[model samples]
Target chain A: MILKVENLNKSFGGILASRNLDLQVEEHEVHAIVGPNGGGKTTLMAQLSGLSKPDSGKILFKDRNITPLSTHKRVHIGLASSFQITSIIQSMTMLDNILLAVQSLQGHSYKFWAPVSGDAGMRETALNVLENVGLGRQADTVAGKSSHGEQRQLEIAMALALEPDLLLLDEPTSGMSKEESGEMVRLLKKMKGEKTILLIEHDLDAVFALADTTSVLVDGRILATGTAEQIRSNPKVQQAYLGEETA
Target chain B: MFKFLENLPARVYLAVTALLAVAPLLVTLGSQPFYLDLLTRILILAIAAVSLNLIIGFGGMISLGHAAFIGIGAYCVGIPAHYDIFNGFIHLGLAISCSAAFALITGAISLRTHGLYFIMITLAFAQMLYFTFVSLDEYGADDGLIIYQRSDFNGLLNLENPTTLYYTVLVTLLGLLYLMHRLVHARFGRVIIGCKHNEKRMQALGFDTYRYKLTCYVISGTICGIAGFFLGNFTNFISPEMMDWTHSGELIFMIVIGGTAGIFGPVVGTAFFLLLEEMLSGLTQYWQLIFGLVLILLVVFGKGGVHGLLVWADTRQTAQAQPENDS
Candidate 1:
């Protein structure tokens, strides 16, 4: 397994966000977690991303325990994530935003004397990543000016810039139109095997279309974990979490 | 043609600066001693304004107690010069070191809070410094201090001569502006602005935003301290009133009038403000009332100050040209 969570538990004052939550994601696997509104999906994702620490648990990545690491350290260790609410530098161009992220990952190659505009290698790599998300035409446009769907794609491209071994996306399709959601699903499908992906999402259609394995989470506990077919047919998962029609 | 102007050589900027540096010497249309003195004062204030812009414009830090840093710097020079410790370089060095130390200490505490709270704490600390300076009877308590003469430099520059003094301030201001330009474009500058916009995002991206903010505060204080040194030399006097809260307001006002986006905005604004004071004072003794009204107008209409107005014009011009490209 590329990521292993052993008995993670987190509580806030009197509220339990997660209780004995255990999950494992193998290399190159697309793991999907579906849960109800108050089902602690974001809390689990935050813990994994190192944004918030688990009250008690061991999170192991590549056989190394990272329970005590910081968010940036987690990023340096080949783990990257996209925010649920868009986090972008509004004044800078989309390309510049992605280029900064790429620069961070590329072994301290920041040269203050040379203008980034004329650097062909950096520009070309940024262009390729922009093209991957169909934002090639909007590369020079400020990140703030782009449509919401395009902004979401820019967020993913930012994550891709890190060239992480695993990518964690929290609600990549939230607040997107039906067509935009479909495009996001298609994009994620293309991203499979290029890197390990752990997704927290609610849009069942996209999840069913993209996930190889599905886990049901309810009230901070994992209900079941199985192949997509098994998850689709599980009665307890249908009645308790994923409505009968969706199952 | 537009693209050529947009990518104009840095030499053009350097040339303008060079001309400004030598303007007083080259032009002797009116060689009034008072005019020279007034111009020197404007130059000193311009330096202070520019340093404040480093924090206010580029770093997005709203410092209301900036004048206190200027006060610390002036006293650093005045107290030593008063006591006959007349080494010019050492006085300047002491001034800068004192201001930087103050910034480091206050910034550590003030930066822990955000937004309005940050502004308030900084203002409060500056007031504390102001009162402390006022209580020092040796420096003249609330009355202020007078320098019998400018510092005696060892075989270098004599500040007693008006022309020599003007050039001295001119060189220092130009050096600071150049440094500020280079700083804002560097990697550290980008991170500073990035943190200003979205600190949480910068942290998520693995940058320690607090350190960047504290460093900016120190740099701003140090630069303001330089201005304070010039201020003392220009007036040949220093006082507890130098660190007054109203003086801080004026420093902020200079940045606002100049527009905070570009380096030279503060210089332009300072020149314009002092000129207005000169022209208006000639008209009436009650010139401050008119100055206040004009400031209000500038704030209301010129949202980005004078420089911001220029940027708005440029942005509109670019937006207008977009249709031509589309065609």
Candidate 2:
């Protein structure tokens, strides 16, 4: 398994976020987690990404436990995530946004005297990542001024720049229009098998189209785990979740 | 309604800086030692503002203990002179190391708390240093210490001559400005600004933002310490007054008025503030009252600052050119 969560639990003051959650994601596969709102998809992803520590659990990635790590430590060890709300450095240029991520992956940015633009190799790599996201021409555009769809794509491009072995995508198409959503789906579909992706998405169409396996998370536990075909027809899953949404 | 100076082109900024570089000639022609001395103080203070701008303006770390660094630098000069060792090289080296060390220690602890909490902690530290300096009876305690001899550069540069000192300050200001400009465009600078804009995002992308902020803070202290060294040479005095919290607020005010975004905004802002204070003080003993009122008016009327006004004008001009496309 590329990722394994063993009996993980987390709670707030009075509410449980993740309750004895256990899951596994095989290498080079798209694992989609779908749940009703507040079902703790984000909390699980957070624990895995090290945004917050679990109350008690072991989160193993490639057989190495990473539950004790911090957010940046997880990133340094080939795990990267894109935020649901687009955590972008808004005041900076789009190229600058991606270039910062690129610079971080390359190592410490202690080169004070040399201009970032003067490094032809790093600049071209940043530009290529931007182009892949279809933001090639808007390289110099201020990130905040970019359209909502562009910002979402830029968010992923930053994660991609890390060259992570595993990518955590939290609602990659949130707040996007149908057309923009289609573009994002196509992008993710094209990127499948290139790396292991743990996708947390609400769009049922996207999950069905892209996921090799779908895990139904309800009340902080995996209700069912199966292929799209198996999960679609499973009476328990439909009665619990798919039935409510489709109803 | 176009005010020529208000709507001046970008090139005029360079011209104004150039004009200040030769202001010594104009002052000497007028045979005014007082104005020369005042302008020299402006240059030195401008250096501190520029250095402060590196962390506050670019790095977005609102440090309130900046004057503490200046005090540390002044002591580097004052303490050595008190011991009868007046070498320029030794003074400069001491200023850099001591202030940088203070920044490192204070910054490590202080950077852990951000925003208003960060401000208060830094202020508390600065006040601690101020009181500590106040208790040093060997350095004249609360009264302050006077330098009997200026830093000797082996007859290479005369710190004693007012004209030489004024020109010396101007050149240092320009040189430091160039170095800082180079810095803000560098990769390290990009990380600092990125962290300011969205620290969580920067960290998630794998940059150790804590170390970056601490480094910027240390560099700022080291640079401000250089300004302190100059301040000691100019005034021939060092005291706890130099490290007061109010003086740190004044440095912040200068940057705000000049627009911290541009490379020379802090310097330009320093010039505006000190010149206004000098003119107002000459006219009235109640200059501070008038100055406070004008500063309030400036903050309300000026959006972003003087440099921001220029940026706004540039954007408006572009919008005018592409009228159909934008709106």
Candidate 3:
């Protein structure tokens, strides 16, 4: 397994965000976590990404416990996440955004005298990452001026630049239009076998299309885990989530 | 040459540097020695503003206690000079180290808070330093201290000469401006700018942003401290008043007036502020009241200050010229 979560628990004030949440993601498999609104999908992603601490649980990445690691430290050890609400440096160019991720993985960024733009190798690497996300043509476009769909692509490009072992993508197509969503699915479909992605997605079509394994989360607990066929047939998952949508 | 001149801000920068180079000669020819002193003072404060811009303008760190470094730097010179130590190197070393140390310690705590709280905590630290300096009666306290002789460079350069001092200050400013240019384009600079735009995103991108910001804060303080070293030599006076929050506010005003986006903006802002202060104070005692109104109008209508106006004009010219080229 690339990732293992054991009985993870988190509560905010009086509400429980995660309760005895257990999950496992296999190497090079696209694992999708699907649920209704506020079903603790993001909370589980947050805990796994080291953005928040679980009150009672252990998170193991590559079989080593990473429950107490900070967000940046987890990233350094090959775990990178993309936010649900699309977090990117708006004032910089799309290429520059990816360059930041590339720079981070290369070495310490205490280099003050030499200009980063002059580093031809780093620029090429960043460009290649952008190209992989189909944003090579818009490399010079300021991120804030880019279309929402383009920004989402840039966001994934940034996370991919880290070359992480496991990618935690939270609702990558949340704010995208139908065409944009199709483009995103195609992009992810290309990376399906090569990358281990723990995806939290709302789009059922996307989940069925991309996910190698699907897990149903309900009220901060895993209701069921199976293939698309089994998940669609599972009575518990259908009653808790899929049934609500279909009905 | 014409193509180079097409860039308005670059042209202005070149013209300003050339004028400053000949300013001392001009003052001598006009027999107005007072203008030399005024220009020297402006150059010194411009250095401070430029340093502050590293954090405020570029790094998105709005520190309200930047003048504290100036005060600390001045004291580094004053305290040693009091005991008959005239070594320029020693004074500079102390100034840089002391200011850097102070910034590191304060920044460690202050950077943990964001926005208004960060501003408040920084102000509180400066006030703390101000009071500490005021209570030190051994170093003249609230009354201040004086240096009988300028820092001795052992005949390398003469601070005793007004013209020499002006050139020295000018060289320092130019060197710093070049350094700032190099810095903002470097890896370190990109990280700082990224943090400014979105700290959380930067963190997610595997950057330990707090450490980068703290390092930037220290760099800004150290540069400002160097400016303070020059200020002590020029004014020949060191006092707690030098670090008053109002003085820090004035530094911010200078940066805002010139423009914050460009590396040279603070220098232009400093010049505008001092020259306007000089002209208006000569006209009336209520110069500050008029200054207040002008600043209010500038902030309200002029979004980018003087530098922004220059950029706007440059872009317009480029747009107008584009059609001619196409035709």
Q: Which candidate number would show the highest lDDT if scored against the true structure?
A: 3
Which regions of candidate 3 deviate over 4 angstroms? Answer: B1-6
Sorted on DockQ, best first, the list reads 3, 2, 1
Instruction: Indicate the worst ten consecutive residues by lDDT in candidate 2 chain B.
Output: B1-10
Query: In order, what DockQ does each candidate have?
Result: 0.38, 0.80, 0.91
In the range B1-327, model 3's lDDT, one tens digit per residue, is 478676899899989999999999999999999999999999999999999999999999999999999999999889999999999989989999999999999999999999999999999999999999999999999999998888888888899999999999999999999999899999999999999889988989999999999999999999999999999998899999999999999999999988999999999999999999899999999999998998889878888888999999999998999999999
- Interface RMSD score of candidate 2: 1.0
Candidate 2 segments whose C-alpha is farther than 4 A from its true place: B1-10, B317-327
Clash count for candidate 3 is 0
Best by TM-score: 3
- The TM-score of predicted model 3 comes to 0.98
lDDT of 1 at B210: 79
Worst-scoring 10-residue span by lDDT in model 3 chain A: A43-52
> Per-residue lDDT tens digits of candidate 2, residues B1-327?
345344444555878787887888988798886888888898999999999999898988998878888898889999999999999889989999999999999999999999999999999999999999999999999999999888888888999998888888888889998888788889889999888888888889988889999999998999999999999989999999999999999999999898888778888889899999999999999999999998988778986777888788877876777877766
DockQ (C-alpha) of model 1? 0.38
Candidate 1 residue pairs in backbone clash: none
